[model samples]
Target: MRIEIVEGDITVRPVDAIVNAANSSLLGGGGVDGAIHRAAGPELLEACRELRATKLPDGLAVGAAVATPGFLLPAKWVIHTVGPNRHAGQTNPALLASCFTESLRIADGLGARSVAFPAVSAGVYGWDARKVAQLGIEAVRAYAGRPLEGEKPMVELVEFVLFSEETAGIFRQALEESGGGPG
Candidate 1:
């Protein structure tokens, strides 16, 4: 497995799957969620609607992940995971860590060789950027160290597609501290 740090919009990444830092409703809101929803068009919303209508009627739970087609986006699939909101008293780092791990698990299940992830809770969710970076790198490296659910994980690349250079710098620092350089 390879780890990378890049500052860019998550929606335009051409990876096999992209992780969406969605709210529990999975219906779409702000930040990465809104951008992904907008870029993927109405079909994406319909898919999410179908998911809500059937499987996730009460909305997705925090740290859990689910998949929907990327629709008009470049990625083949979108893995939606809810991050722990620190302001809402969901301050446990374990829940934040789960977002990365579960998203990877879902990605692996979908046969995704390459995945792009945003800083799951660093923005509007009120988590510190450094904390989000550390947990993200730690979870992804741990995921890489383990065997896949089926065959060995097809995940050749895991890219932290950050929204800005400062955030990317934070992730890069974490990756390096974990003995991984930008790839």
Candidate 2:
């Protein structure tokens, strides 16, 4: 697998799937979630509404993930995962790691070759950026190292689309420190 750290908008990425750091509602909120919803246009909301009306009536759980078609965005699919809210006293790093893990699992199921991701829980959720970077990188690395049930990994590329250079640097450092070699 190839891992990349990029400072840009994930909505514009030409990957097969893009992961949204969404709230449980999955309808759309502030930060990356709102950007993805707007970029994907109204159809994205319609799809999400259908998801809520049927499959996810109670809303998505934190760390769990669901996929929707990326209507207007450059990506083909959008993988939505709710990050644990630090303000809500949810301090488990496992929850944050699960965000990355579950998203990749869903993307793999979709047969996505490339996926872009934002720094989950590092924005309005109030998680520390460095820690989030560390956990996210670790989770992706571990997942990539282990092929699924004797099948080759479907997702080949994982790109971290950071909103700022500082965040990108943090992720880069974490990746390098984790022996991922600046990817």
Candidate 3:
């Protein structure tokens, strides 16, 4: 898989899918969630509401992921994953890694060639940026390293869309340290 670290808004990424660092509700909250909802218009909220009323009545679980149409966003699909909130005492790095793993799995199921992701749990959730970057990169690398049965991996490009240059640098450093040079 090709991984790229770009500093920008994920909502504008022209990939097959964009992963949202959503709250458990999935109906949209602050940060990337609100920005994506606002950019995708009301249809995104309606879709999320339908999911909530039906499949996810109690809301999504941390480390789990579900996909919805991208609506007004540039991407074709929106893969929403609830990252573990460290402020809520959910400090497991594995759980944070699961967010990236599950989102990529969902993207593969959708036959997405490329997917863009935010620094899940590293923002208002109060997780350490360096750790988040390391876990996020490691999870993607490990997932991509696993061979699929018969066919090649559906998702080829994994882009990290960070909000700031500092965050992007952290991810780049992590990627470099992992021998996966910044793309």
Q: Which one wins on lDDT?
A: 2
Runs of candidate 1 with Cα error greater than 4 angstroms are none
TM-score of candidate 2 relative to the true fold: 0.97
Number of clashes in model 2? Answer: 0
What's the ranking of the predictions by TM-score, best on top? 2, 1, 3
Q: Pick the candidate with the highest TM-score.
A: 2
User: For residues 76-179, could you state the per-residue lDDT of candidate 2 as single tens digits?
Assistant: 99999999999999899999999999999899999999999999999889999999989998899889877667677899899999999999999899888888
Stretches of candidate 2 exceeding 4 Å from the true structure: 180-183
Q: For each candidate, give its TM-score against the true structure.
A: 0.96, 0.97, 0.96
Whole-model lDDT, candidate 3? Answer: 0.91
In candidate 3, list every pair of residues with a backbone clash: none
Q: On a 0 to 100 scale, what is the lDDT of residue 12 in model 1? A: 93
| Steric clash pairs (candidate 1) | none
For every candidate in turn, the CA RMSD to the true structure comes to 1.2, 1.0, 1.3
